[model samples]
Target: MKRILWITLCLAVMSSCSCRQEPEQVALDFLQSFFASDYKQARVYAAPEIMGILDKSQSIFDSLTPEEHQEVKDYLSAINITVEAPEKIKGDTVRLPYRVEFSRLKEPGESFITLRREGRNWKVYALE
Candidate 1:
């Protein structure tokens, strides 16, 4: 019984410690949460700098009335964003390329998210 308990405890700790996701996944999660207006969830994947930017933008989002905010969210929900595999990885940083498509867009716009390795985790913090 003691050995079984110890093994279970070790496995739980190891699994939790290894929960860090890939940069592409972090970017997708951050973008989705941001678009959904779920700032709290987005913060989990964003770096402090990105959070600063998001906070400022959120202030603008906040200025809108409740109905306006919902309208904006509805519009954004119709847009489609496709994330691709990482296009570049150097040292401890990675660039994940993605495409954004919407009715207003004549063609998909290409962009990339920049992530830096922070300890065992990847943090989404930049764009290009």
Candidate 2:
């Protein structure tokens, strides 16, 4: 009985730890898609609330000069992404925090973003 109880306790702890998604991996996937100029793929990781913001920002997106657009696209592609915060697991969901950096017309720029898990997938939460 004692051995069985100890084994069960150990298994529970290990299972919980192993079930977690690595925040770095999610952050990299998001950054890579964004860098490749694949907004659609990146959108897959965006939370529903983020999609709404993107919708409202469409006009801002359309007003960009071709060079500016390409520059932004290309710069985002080249940078390395890092997760500033590990995901906080909550009843099958996780929230991750990240920071991205890139050079813009010879000037360095940075932004903070959040990602949230939806079902079995992850999505960007918002721009900070």
Candidate 3:
């Protein structure tokens, strides 16, 4: 019984330690939420500085009429976004590059997203 208890404790510890999600996944989730007009959910992934900015602004979707909102959603849906793996650019900072493609666009759009390590979690530091 003691041996079994010890094994169970070790497994629990391992699982708990692995619970943190990858930074790239967090960035993708943030983008998905932002584009889907779920600012509340998107804010969860933002760092405190970014969250403050988001809090001060009116909802990007809330200001639009229903038709406009639909149009925006359609435009976002029509675009294809691809996020690359994050690379450490400096201490506690990572740079993530992603590509955005649209049928009507003459060229794919590319941008770098920044992330910073906050305690055990990664947060969205900036979007550029």
Candidate 4:
């Protein structure tokens, strides 16, 4: 009976951990939608908690000057984005590490992004 209980506990732990998604894959999918400028698709992956914040972000984007919009788009387009590592999943959140290579710029940089599991899907929280 004790051995059976131990086996059951081990299996339960393994199954729970198996359900985790790879953070890098989640980040890549989100970035693809972002680079495509598809906010609608992107929103499908946003955390419910940040829906209001992202909506406000859309308004802020609408307020950007034409030149600024073009500049940001142009700058981002020149970079190659790749996920470097997956951070640990904690509670409702998972943080992913990424690297950006700028083809047109002299120097490039790396950064991290976070994703939170919302319902059955993972949403990119914000990039930093």
**Tens digits of per-residue lDDT for model 3, 1-128:** 99999999999999988978788888888877776666799898999768865665336667889999889888877767778985544677788997878898999989988889888888998888
Alpha carbon lDDT of each predicted model = 0.84, 0.64, 0.81, 0.72
Models 1 onward score TM values of 0.84, 0.54, 0.80, 0.58
Clashes of 1: 0
Scored by Cα lDDT, where does model 2 land? 0.64
Candidate No. with top TM-score: 1
Give the 10-residue window scoring lowest on summed lDDT in candidate 4: 30-39
Residue-by-residue lDDT tens digits, candidate 2, 1-128:
99999999999999987766555566667667755666567676667777766555544556789998887676666675666655345553444555555553465445666666666555677666
Segments in model 4 whose C-alpha atoms lie over 4 Å from true places: 1-21, 63-75, 87-92
Candidate 2 vs candidate 4, lDDT winner: 4
Clashing pairs in 2: 35-77, 45-123, 45-124, 46-124
lDDT of 1 by residue, 71-95 (tens): 9899888777778876566788888
User: Candidate 4 on 2-93: residue-level lDDT in tens?
Assistant: 99999999999998788666667778766766665556776766666656766776677678899987876776676677886644556877
Best-fitting candidate, measured by lDDT? 1
